[model samples]
Target chain A: MLARLARARTGGLAALVAVVALLPLALTNNYHYEVAIVVGLNAIVCVGLNLLIGYAGQISLGHAGFYGLGAYGSAILTVRYGWPPAAALVASTAGAAALAYLVGRPILKLRGHYLAMATLGMGIIISIVIATEDRVTGGPDGMAVAPFAVLGFTLAGERVWYWVIGAALALAVWLSLNLIDSPAGRALRALHGSEVAAQVAGVDPARYKVLAFVISAVFAAVAGSLTAYYAGFITPAKASFLHSIELVTMVVLGGLASTFGAVIGAAVLTTLPQVLTLLKDYEMMVFGAVLMLCMIYLPRGLVPTIADALARRRR
Target chain B: MSTFTLKHFTRAALAASLAFGAAAAMAQAPIKIGAFLSVTGPAAFLGDPEQKTLELYVERINAAGGVLGRKLQLVSYDSGGDAEKARTFAKRLIEQDAVDAIVGGSTTGETMAVVPLVEQAGVPFVSLAGAVVIIEPVKKWVFKTPHTDRMACEKIFVDMQARKISKIALISGSGGFDKSMRGQCLKVAPNYKIEVLADETYGGGDTDMTAQLTKIKNTAGVQAVLNAGFGQGPAIVTKNFRQIGLTVPLYQSHGVASKEFIKLAGPAAEGVRLPAAALLVAETLPDADPQKKVVVGYKRAYEERFKQDVSTFGGHAYDGLMLVVEAMKRAGTTDKAKVRDALEGIKGFMGTAGVVNMSPADHMGLDLTAFRMLEVKNGDWALVK
Candidate 1:
C-alpha cells in the first residue's frame, strides 16, 4: 500500500473506490444518498473540466452550455421522438462533442480572457436558444425526461443512482489519469507550458487544444445526460452562466493539475452548500468565506496541498 | 493528550447531553408542516414572503392551541430557486422529517419538480404557485392557492372586450410563466373577438426591450399592448414602451401583479392594467365584499409581524396553509389520505385569494372570479372599476 501510494494514480483511485463503497454506511436516509449522487455527478464534470483547464491550459467559461445541450438533446430525443434512453444518451454526447469541435476550432485559438469571453458568449447563446425555442425545449420551464432505462432495467431511487453516478465519476477520473500519462497528454502539457515552444517541438498546438476541448465537452455532456435522467427534469438553468461559473470554480478550487483534486473540489463544494443550509440566509456569505479562506491558505488547492504536506512529513 | 483538550472535550460532551435531554423531554411530537421555497434565489422575493407567511400562520395556529390539539411545527427549506434542490428537500421533508402536510413551492418550476415526490410520498401538498399545470391533470396529493395564468388571460380578455378594444400587440419574456400566459392568450383571444397584430419576445436578462417595443409600436391597428412576463423584464418593457411614446393601453399578465413592478417602471406603469388577486386592493374593496374582511385581516397581521407591505405571493402561502389546516380539521386526523380526501371535498372555504371550492376534478378550487382587474394609478394598485 505504501509503495502504491508513492505512485498517486493507483493509490488515489483505490481510496476513492473504497470511500464510494463505504459511504452508504454513513448515509442514513434518501436525502443523504441524493446529495451524494449529486456530488458524484458534479465531480464527473469537474474531472473533465480539469483536463481542459489544468492539463491543456485552456479556460472555458461556458462548459455548462455543453452540459445543457447534452441534457436537452437526450431529453428531446427520448421525450419527443421516443428513442431509447441509452441510445439518446450516446447521441447527445456525440452531438455535444461535435458542437464543441465546431465552436472550439476558432475560440480555442484565443487564450486567457478572450477565450473566457468567447465561451461566455457561446453559453449565453445556447441558453437563449433553449429558453426561446419553447416548442422543443419547453422554454424556461424545462421539460421532464422519461425514466432512464438500459435494456429492461429502470434506474430508480437515490441508492441506485448513487452507485451509478459513483461509477461514472470513477471512470471519468480513471480516463483522465490515463490521458494525462499518454503521448497526447504530453502534447497538451507541452503546449500548456508554451504554445510557441511546443510548436517548435513539433506539437500541433491548435490540434491538441481542440482535441482537449472536445473531449472535455463530451465528459460534460455525459454528466449532464446522467443528471437529467437522475433528476427526471431538465431546465435551461442547467446551461445558464451560473452553472458554468460553478464548474470552473470547482476545477480551480480543487487544484489545476491534480485529478484527485478535481474530485475533492467537487465533493467539498457540492456538500458544503447542503451543510450550509443550516445557516439559512447566511449560507451564501459563509460559502464565500470558505472559498476565500481555502484559496488564501492552500493556494495549490485542497488535495494537492494535503498531498504536499504528507510528502514533506515523510521526508 | 493535554489538559486543555480534556477540558474542552468535557464541555462539548456536557453540551451534547443537555441538548439530547431537552430533545427527549419534548416527547409528544408536534404536527409538522414541511415547506420548501425559493427563499434566497433569483425568485427570493416570491419565496421570502411565502416562507414568512408559513412561519406566521404556524405560530398563530400553535398559539390558538395548534391543530387537532397538537402543536404545529413548520419545517422549511430554502430551495434557492433550483428544481434539483427542491426535489432533494422534498425527499428530506417526507422521508426524514415525516411532515403531515406540505404548503409551499413559490415558483412554477419548484412546484412541478416536487409534484411527483409528493404524490409518491402520499402527503397532502397545497402549492402557492400559479401554474395551471400544478393542479391540472390533477395529482391526487396536490392543490394550489394562486389563480392560474389561464384565468388571468381570461380576465384580461374580458376587460378588453368590455372596452371594445380588440387588436393587441403581445410582447412577452421567454420564460415558462410568460410563455404559458402567451399561449393561453393566443388560444383564448378569438373567444373575446381580439386579434393579435404582432407577437414579440425578449430574453429575461435583456436590459433593453426597446427593439421588441419598437416593432410593436410600428404595428398598425394595435389598440392595446400586453406584456406577459414576471420580474423586472416586464417593468423594463413598460419603461421602454413609455419612452418610445406608444400610447396604446398597456396590459400585463398576473405574473407582474406586484407593487415592485409599479416601482420599477415608475411613471411608465401609470394606467397599466393586469388581473390580480383581490388581496392587492383589499383596502379599497367595499365592506360588503366577502374577500375584503379576510384580505384586510391577513394583510394587517402579516405587515405587523414582518414590518413590510403584504404581497399577493405571500397571500398565496397564507391561503394554502389555512386551506390545508381547514382540510385537516374537517378530516379530524393527520392521516395523509384522509386530509387529501377532505381537501378535495372542501367548498365555500373563504380564503384571502378567493372563495375556494375543491373537488376531485379541480384541485385549485377557484376560477376567473378569484382574480380582479386592477390598474396602476399614481404608483399604486387600484380597482379597474
Candidate 2:
C-alpha cells in the first residue's frame, strides 16, 4: 500500500478519494452535505460514462433517460409497491439493463449523429411517459423516494447517506480502475481507437460496444437508485436531455478514460454553482462562461491535465 | 502608433469603461431577492412576462419603501425551464447571494427542482408556478400564491356543470400538473355531470396537437374540449379546431392565459373560456369592482415599467412576493417558522391573485373567486362573465 502510495498517479488518486470519502466531516450544513453526496452520485454515473464515451469513443446525449427510469422505478417499487429498497434497486438496475439492451440494439446500429438523435428521442419519450403516467409515476409533480433500508434498518440523516454514497462511489471507482486495466478494457480501447482496426485485431467490436453500453447504463441505474433512496424524491427531469448533457460534461470535464477524472469533474461542476451563488441572476451566464473556459483552457479535462503536470514535475 | 491603432485603443477603452459601469451597478447594496425564471426556453413566452413582472414589482416595492424597510432588490436567474439549472440557481440564491426569498420559475417541474434546496436551508420560498405538488405534503418552508391545476380544473368543471356542458373532450400534457388537472377534471366531472368523451395526451415541445384533437372532434356528443396543459393549449385551440372543423365551445386550462397564447392562437381564442386567477383580465375590468384596486394598480405599474402587458404568470409571482412581505410584516422578523405560520394563517389579504385566505390545511388560499370566466377579446384576456 505504501509502495502504491509512493507512485505519483496512484498516490494522488488515493488521497483524492480519501478526501472525498471524508468530505462530510468538513461539511456541517445539510445543504453542503447534500450537494457533496449528489456530486458523489454524479461521479459514480460519470465513471461508467467515461468508459463508454472516453474508452469506447461513443456519444450518449441521452443516458439521463436510463437514470430517470432507474430513479422512478426504484422509488415507485419501494415506496408504492412496498418492495424492499434493495429489491427495488435490483429491479431498477435490471429494468434499466433490459431497456438499454432493447434500445441500444436499434439505436447503436444508427451510428454518429443519427445515434445521438435516437438516444435523445428515447430520453424525451421516457420523460414524456413518466410525466404523463401521473397515477403511477406522479407525473411532473415528482415522486417521493423510499429511504434506503437494509435488514429493517432505515437510513436517515445526511450523515448516513454521505457515507452510503461515498462508499458506493469508492467501490465504483475501484471497479472502473480494475476494469480499465483488464483484457476487455484493452479491447474497448482498441475499439475506441478505430472500429475497423479493432475488428481486424479480432476484438469483436460489436460485442465490446454493446457490453460497454450495458455496463455504463448499469452504473447510471445504480446511481439513480441511490439518488432516489437518498433524496426521497425523484422527477422526470432526472431523465431530461439537459441532464444527459450534464453527465457527459462531467465525464469530459473530469478527463474521459481517467478514473479519477470522473470524480473530479463531478465535484467541480457540482460545487462551482454553490460558489458562484453570489452571481444570483447571472449564475447561468457564469456557468456557461466557465464551461467555455474549461473547454478552451483544459481540452483534456482537469484530472488528466493535473496528473500530467505532477508527472512532469516528478521527472 | 498609427491612426488605426489609436482607434482600436479607443474602442477597447470604451468597452472597458462600459464593463466597469455595469460592474458598479451590479454591486449596489440592497435587500435582494434572487429569482429563477424560465426565460429563453420552451416556457420563455410565459416566463418573459414573469421576468417583467418581477422587475416591475421590485421597482414598485422599492418605490413604496421596499420590504423590511430596505429597498427590495431583485436579481433574477433564468432556469430556461430546466430542473438542474433551477437547482443550480436555487443554491446560488440561498448559499451565494443569501436572497430573502425566491420567486418565478414558470412550471411545476421547475418549482419542484428548487424545493429541496430551499427546504434544506429553511428559506421561505414563494413560487409563481402553479403545481400543487410544490407546496403539498407541506414542506413548511415553501408556498405558492397561484391557484393549482387541480383547483382550476375543479373550478372549470363546476362552471361547465352550471353551463350544462356534460360531454367534454380532455387533452393534457404528460406533466405533473397536467396529469393532476386531468385527474381532477375527470374526478369532479361526474360530480358536475360532465362526461369526458376522450382523454388525449401530448408531451413537451410537441407543436402539433391535431391528431389528439381530431380524435376528440370525431367523438359523438362532445360539447366542449377541455385542454388541461400549457405550451400547446392555444395551438390546439386554433389549428386543430379549424383543421377538424369542429365549432364546439372550447374551454382551456389556466396555463393558456399567457399573452403568447393569444398571439399563438390568433382570433380562434375569442370564445374560449378558461378559469384564470383575476390578474390576467385586470386591465379591461370595470373601474369600480373596487376589490381589484391593488390588482389594477399592479397591472398598470407592470405595463408602465415593462412597456408590455401583464399575464397571469408574473401576476402570481407578484402576489407571492407581496404575500411574503405581508407575512414578514406580521411575523416581524425573517423567522422561517413565523413566516410559514403567518402565511398559513393569513386571511382576507387582497392580492393580484385574489383575496388570499391561507389556512393550515389549505396552502393555496385562492379559489374560483380568485378567477371569473375570462375570454380573449381583441387579442387580450377580458372578463367574460
Candidate 3:
C-alpha cells in the first residue's frame, strides 16, 4: 500500500509536468499562453489554499489579502525604493508569511463561519487601504510595476512567463503533495476530522492550524508577486473580497484534499470566462449556469467525484 | 486548326486572371479596432453605452464607404471592471487580434492598467476613462477622450472667476475620482486667484453630508461651493445642501453632468452648475457653435438606435472611434506609427466633446473651450450662457 501511494504521487507529478510541457503545442498564439500562465498562477495559489481549507479544515475568506499584500509589497519595493525584483519578491512573500503567522494564531482559534468573516474583514481592510493610500499604491488607479529581473536579465513576454509560472506551479504541487504525505499532514487531517479527538491523540491543533495558514499565505503571496511582475501593473482589485472568494471557490470546485483537483479547478475557472466570450451579452448568465450545473452534478467536486467513479468501476 | 484552338485557350486564361485580380482588389482586408470595456460590472454604466456606440458607429462607418475604402472591424471584450482582466483582454487584443488601434478603457483603473501594455505593444490606445494620469507627460501611444479631472477643475474655476466668486468651500468624496479632482482643484485654485475657505470630505459610501455642508455654510465669505464626486454621492450632497438651506451657488464637477443627477437630487438640483460636454445640452446649443451639429447628430442617432438616453460616456466612444477612423483616413494606410502621427496632428475636428486640437504635447487634445458650462433649469440641463 505504501509503495502504491508513492507510485501514485510520482505518477501525478509526472503527469502534471507532462501536461505543462505539452500545453504549448496547443497554444497557437500569445493569448493562449497568457491564459495558461494565469491558470498556473491561480493553480499555485489554490494548491496552498487547499492545504488549509481541505486538509486542516480551516476556512479563510481573506486569503486574497495576503496575495494583495505580496503584490503591492513587491511593486512598491521595486518601483518606489528601487530594490531588485527577485529580492522584492522574496521579501514580500516573507512579509506575507509573517503577517499570516501573527493573524492566523489568533483568528484560526475560531472555527467555520467566524473564521470566514474574520478573513473576509481582513481582505476588505487590505483592499480599502490599497485603494486609499494612493500616494504609494496609486490608490484605485493602480501603479505600474517594474519588469521582473534577476542578475541583470529581464523576463518579458507571455511565452517566457508561461514557463516561469508552469515551473512554479509544479514545485507548488510537489511541495503540497509531500506535506500531505508527511506526519504533519496526518495531524492536519486528523484535526480536521475531529479537533478534540486529534488533541487527545497528541496532535497540537493550534500549531498545525497556524502552520497550514502560514504556508497557504506564502503560496498566495508568491503567486501574487509573480502576477504583479508578470502583468507589469498592480491594482487593489487583486486584494478585493471577490478575488478571495474566487480562490476559495476554485479549491472547493476542484475537490478538497486533492492536490491535482485544485490545479484542475484553477484552470477551468480561469479559462471559462475567456471561452464564454462567444456568448457575448449572455456570457455571465451562461457562466453562472455552468457553475451551478457543475455543483449540482458533482457535489463531491469534479476531481473527487471522477476519481471515486473510476475506483468503483475497477471494483 | 491547332493554332486557332491554342489562341482561344490563351484568351480564356487571360480573362480568368483578370477576374481573379478584380476580386482580390475588392476584398481588401478590414482595419481592426480592438477594445476592452467594463461592460457588465460596477462601471457598466460607463462601458455599456460605450460598447453600443462603437458597434453603432462601426456599422455606420462601413455603410458610409469606410475609412480608406476598407470596412472597420471592432473586436471588443467585456472586462467586468476587473483591472487584471482588463490587462489580459488588452493583451489578447494586441497579441492575437492584432488590432490597428484600441479605443476603450471604461474607468481610470482599467485604463491605467492597460497603459503599460499598449505602450509596450506600440498600439495607439484612446482611453474613455477620465484621469489626468492617462495623458499627463503624454505617453507616446496613449490618448484619451474624456476631459481629465484637472481640466474639470480648471473649467469650474474659470466659471467661478467669471462670476467673481473667489472664496469657495470644497466638499468631496473619498472615492478615487473625487479625491483626484479635489487634489487638482486645490493645486489650481491659486492660478485662478480663488481661495478655498473650507475643505471637507465624506467616505465613498457616506449617505449624509449635512454636517460637512453646515460647516461650509457657516464659513465666512464663501461665495460658491464645489462638490467633486459622482454616482449617488453628488446627488445626496445636492439634496443635503438644499435641506440645510445654503443659498450660495452650488458648483459640481463634470462627474454629475448626467440627467440622472437631476432626477436623483430632485428640485434641489435646479440651480446646480457643472462643466460638461456639449452633448448634454445639445438642443440648447446655438446653430453657429462648431460642436452643435456633430453633438446633435450623434445624440439623435444614438438615442434613435439604442432607445436609451444619450450619455457623455457613449460620446467618448464615438469620439474614440471617429478619431481613429479620421487618423486612418489622413494617414492613407493602416500603419500604426503613421496613424498615431495623424491622430496627434488632428486640429479643429468637431467631436461630441468639442473641437479637438491634438499636438505632441497634448494627447487628450481638448482645452477649456471643449467643456461647456451648464446649469440645471426646470429639471433639465441648460447652457450657462
Candidate 4:
C-alpha cells in the first residue's frame, strides 16, 4: 500500500511537469497563456509555503511582503541601477531570505494566532514603506520592469516564458520531493505532527521553524521577481497585506502538504475570477459564497479529502 | 501590341496599390477607450457616475458621426478601489482587452498603482484619482483629468489666506488617499501663512468623526476647518459641526464635491464650499458660459442613461474619454505613437470640465486656473464668486 501511494505521487508529479511544459500549446492564446504563467508563479510560492505550513506546521500571513521585495528588487535593480534581471532575481531572494531569517527567529517562537499577527504586522510595515517611498518605488504608482534576459538572449512572448517557468517549477518540485524524503524533511514532518514531540525526539524546534520560514520567503521572493519581469510592471500592491492572505489561501485551498494540490489551487483561484466576470454586479458576493462553500464542504481541501474517500470506498 | 499590354499592366498595378492602401486605412479599428473605476467598493459612489460619463459620451460621439468617422468603443472595468486589484485590472485591460487608452482614479491608491501599467503599455491614461504623484513622476503615458491633492491643498489654503483665516484645523481619514491629502494640506498650510491649529485622523468607514471634530472645534483661534476626504468628509460637515455647536465656516476638499454629499449632509450642506473643475456645476451651469451647452447636455444624457446623478468623478471620466477621442480624431488613426503625439500636442481643446491645451511639457494642460469656486445652493452646486 505504501509503495503504491509513492508510485501514484510520483506519477502525479510527472504528469504535472508534462502539462506545464506544454501549457502554451494547450492554452493557444496569449491571454490564456498569461493566466497560466501567473498560476505557475503562484504555484512556486505555494510549494515553498506548503513546506512551512503543510509539513513544518507553521503559518506566515506576511509572505506577500517577501514577494513584493523580490519584485521591487528586480525592478529597481534593472530599471534604476541597470543590473541584469537574473542577478536582480537572486538579490531579491537573498534579501527576503535574510530578513525572514532575522525576523522569524523571534516571531516563530510564538504559536498560532500570535505568530500570524506578528507576520501580519511585518507585512503591513513593508507595504506602508513601499507605498510612501514614491521617489524609490515611484510611490504607490509602481515602476516598469526590464524584460527577462538569460545568457545574452532576450526572453520575449508567452511561449518562451512558459517553457522557462515550467522547467523551473519542475526543478523546484523535484527538489522539494527530495527534501521530503530526506532526514531534515522528516524532522519538519515530525514537527508538524507535534512540535513538543519533535523537540523530545532531539529536533531543535526553533531552528527548524526559522529555517522553513526563510526558505518559504526565498521562494515567494523569487516568484515575485519572475512575475515582475513577465508583467513588465511592479507595484507595492504585490506586498499588500491582502496579497499575502491570498497566497496563503491558495495553499490552504489546495490541501496542505500536497504538491499537485498546490498547483491545482493556484491555477483555479487565479483564473476563477476571470471566468466569474460574468457575475458582474455580484462578483465579490459570489466569490465570497464560493469561498464559504469550499471551506464548509472541502475542509481537508480538494486532494486529500477526495483521495481518502476513494480509498475508504475501495476498502 | 506589346507596348499596349505594358501600359495596361502598369495602370492595373497602380490601381491595385491604391486600393490596398485604402483598405488598410479602413481596416484600422475604432480607438478603444477603457474606463476603470471602483464600481463595487468605497469608491463606487464615484465610479458609478464615471461609468455614466463614458456611456453617455460614447453615445453622443456615435450620434454625431463619431471621431474620424469611427465610433468610440468604451470598455469599462471595476477596480473595486483596491490598489492591487487596480494593478491587475490595468494589465488585463491593456494586454487582453487591447484598449487604446485607459481612464480611472476614484482613489489615489488605485490611480497610482496603474501608472506603471500605463508606462509599460505606452498607452495614454488619464486618472480621476487625485494623487499629485500620479502625474509628477513625468511618466510619459500617465496623466490625470482630476486636480491633484497638492492642487486641492493649494486651492483651499489660498482661499483661506485670501479670506484672512489665520488659524485652522485639518481632520482626515486614515485611508491612503485621505492621509496623502492631509499631508499635502499641512505641507502647503505654512506656505499660505495659515497655521494648522490641530491635525487629527480617523480610520476609514468610521462614522464617529466626533473625536477629530471635538479636537478641532475646541482649538483656540480656529477660524476654519479643512475636511480632508470624500464620502464621509461631507458627513462631518453635516453632523459634527451641529453636534459640537461649532459655527465656523467649513471648507471641504474637492473630493467632497458631489450631490450625494448634499443628500447625506441634509440641510447642513447648504453653504459649504469647495474648489473643483467645471463638471461639478454642469447641472446648474448658466447659459452664458460658452461651454454650458455641452455641460448640460452631458449631465442630462448621463442621468437618463445610467439612472444616477453625476459626480466630479464622472466629470473627470467624461473629460478623459473626450481628450482621448479628440487626439484620435486629430491623428486620424489609432496608431499609438501618433495618438500620443496628438494628445501631448492638444491645443485649445474644449472639454466639458476644462479647456485642455496640452504641450510636451505639461500633460494635464490645465492648472489651478482651470478650477472655479463652487457653492452648494438648493441641493445643487452653484458656481460662486
Please give the lDDT score at residue A307 for candidate 1: 72
**Which structure among the candidates has the greatest TM-score?**
3
Once fitted onto the true fold, the runs of candidate 2 whose alpha carbons sit more than 4 angstroms away are A1-10, A101-118, A194-202, B1-63, B66-106, B110-124, B134-141, B157-178, B197-225, B236-248, B262-264, B376-381
TM-score of 2: 0.84
lDDT tens readout by residue for model 2, A1-315:
322332344564677678876665788655577688878899999989888888877777889988988898898898788998898899989999888788777666544655567778888898878877777887766776667889989998777888888888888877877787789999999887887888898887667767778888899999988888876667677888878998999989888778778888888998886677567568779999998899898899876776677667767
lDDT of every model, 2 decimals: 0.88, 0.77, 0.90, 0.77
Candidate 1 DockQ score? Answer: 0.64
Candidate 1 lDDT (Cα, 0 to 1) = 0.88
RMSD of 1: 4.4
lDDT of 1 by residue, B1-385 (tens): 6999999999997876577436443334588899999998688988999999889999999999998878899889988888888888998899888889998888777888888888887999998877777877989999999888888888999999898899999999876788898898899999889999999989878999999888988889999988889778998998999998999899998887777788899998899999988888889998999888899999999999989999888998999889989998999978789999999999999998899999999999897889999988888988877
**Which numbered prediction scores highest in lDDT against the true structure?**
3
- Best-to-worst order by DockQ is 3, 1, 2, 4
Per-residue lDDT of B1-385 in model 2, one digit per residue for the tens?
6999999999997876577436344334456677888876777876788887777777877898876666777878777776656765677678766776676667777787677767778887888777666767777777787787677877787777778788888888765556677777787777777778799888767778788888887899898888887666556546677767879888887767777787788877777788876676676678877557888888788777778777767777778778878887888755567877888888998888788888877777776778777777777777766
Report, in order, each candidate's fnat. Answer: 0.56, 0.33, 0.75, 0.14
The residue pairs found clashing in candidate 3 are: A134-A139
TM-score between model 1 and native = 0.90
What is the Å distance of residue A154 in model 4 from its true position?
A: 8.7
Q: Report residue A169 deviation for candidate 3 (angstroms).
A: 1.1
Candidate 2 docking class: acceptable
